[model samples]
Target: MSLIQACVTAATTLLAVLIGGWLTVRTQDRLWRRDQERQWRDIRLNAYTDFIGAVREYVAFILNPAARITVVPRPRDPGDLMPFFDDVGSRYRERLESTKTALRLVAGRPEVVSVSAELVRQARLLAAARADSGVEALQADRFDALWEAERRFIETARADLGLPSAFVS
Candidate 1:
């Protein structure tokens, strides 16, 4: 081929290589972002589930009549009951707190964090009741408060994850 034709071919090849590289990089970057998002969603889901589970477990324990009776020697007696209450409360709180790390890592929305904090607060109240007055003192109002807090947390988490408001479970 002539020198001019050779120069034209080289220029065309160089342009094609540049365009191909750019497209490849763009596609790879998009895929990488998508993967990161999916991973974060999974982490958030696990954290929410764990936190809810911990709260529910604590509530159930306190609400059970047997647990209340066993924990409290008598309604008026305040001797030696606190140690048992403390042990149960600390164990469940630690489980819940462990999941908070994962939650803070992936929770981007403020509502999700706030609702989760409500769950923690409600759990603490239940723990305090168990500590001070025993399970007999865990009234319906307390359970209702915790239940409402849990529902709000679930709704906020679903919204943050792009799920429909009507989404159940």
Candidate 2:
């Protein structure tokens, strides 16, 4: 081959190597990003589920007839429940707080944080309602509002995590 032809062949080979390397890197970067997104979505799902579960447990304790009685060791007698109140309240409160902290660590969007705060607020309202009236009052008046807040939180978290919503037609 001519010297000029040999140089041209080498230049073409170098160019092909560079282009192939760039494409490979670009494809790998895209795959990495997709994997990261999926991992993040899973974390958000776990956190959100935990937070809701804690909230439900709290509400259940409030609505439980036994919660109204005051006594230590949690009276087995259905009539004596006052002592169980403080323990149940604090235990569920800790669970809710722990879940919220986990969510704060994993949440990528500000709206999810905001909605989580709303969920906490609504759950507190249910607790307060139970205190003011009775379990019957919570079922009557406060349950709907708490349900709505929880629904909003779930929807917002799903959107933030890029999960598809059944509500979207």
Give the whole-model CA lDDT for all candidates, comma-separated.
0.72, 0.77
Give one digit per residue, the lDDT tens place, for model 1 in 3-92.
999999999999999999999999999999999999888888887788778777766666655553223343452322322444555575
Error of 2 at 105 (Å): 1.9
Best by TM-score: 2
* Cα-lDDT of candidate 1: 0.72
* Model 1: pairs clashing at backbone N, Cα or C within 3 Å: none
lDDT tens per residue, model 2, 16-95: 99999999999999999999888888888898889889888977777787675333332343322232257656787788
lDDT of 1 at 155: 88
Q: Among all windows of ten consecutive residues in candidate 1, which has the lowest summed lDDT? A: 74-83
Candidate 2, position 96, lDDT: 83
Best by lDDT: 2
lDDT value, residue 100 of candidate 1: 67
Clashes of 2: 7
Residue ranges of candidate 2 with Cα displaced over 4 Å: 68-85
lDDT of 2 at 165: 75
Minimum summed lDDT over a 10-residue window in model 2 is located at 74-83
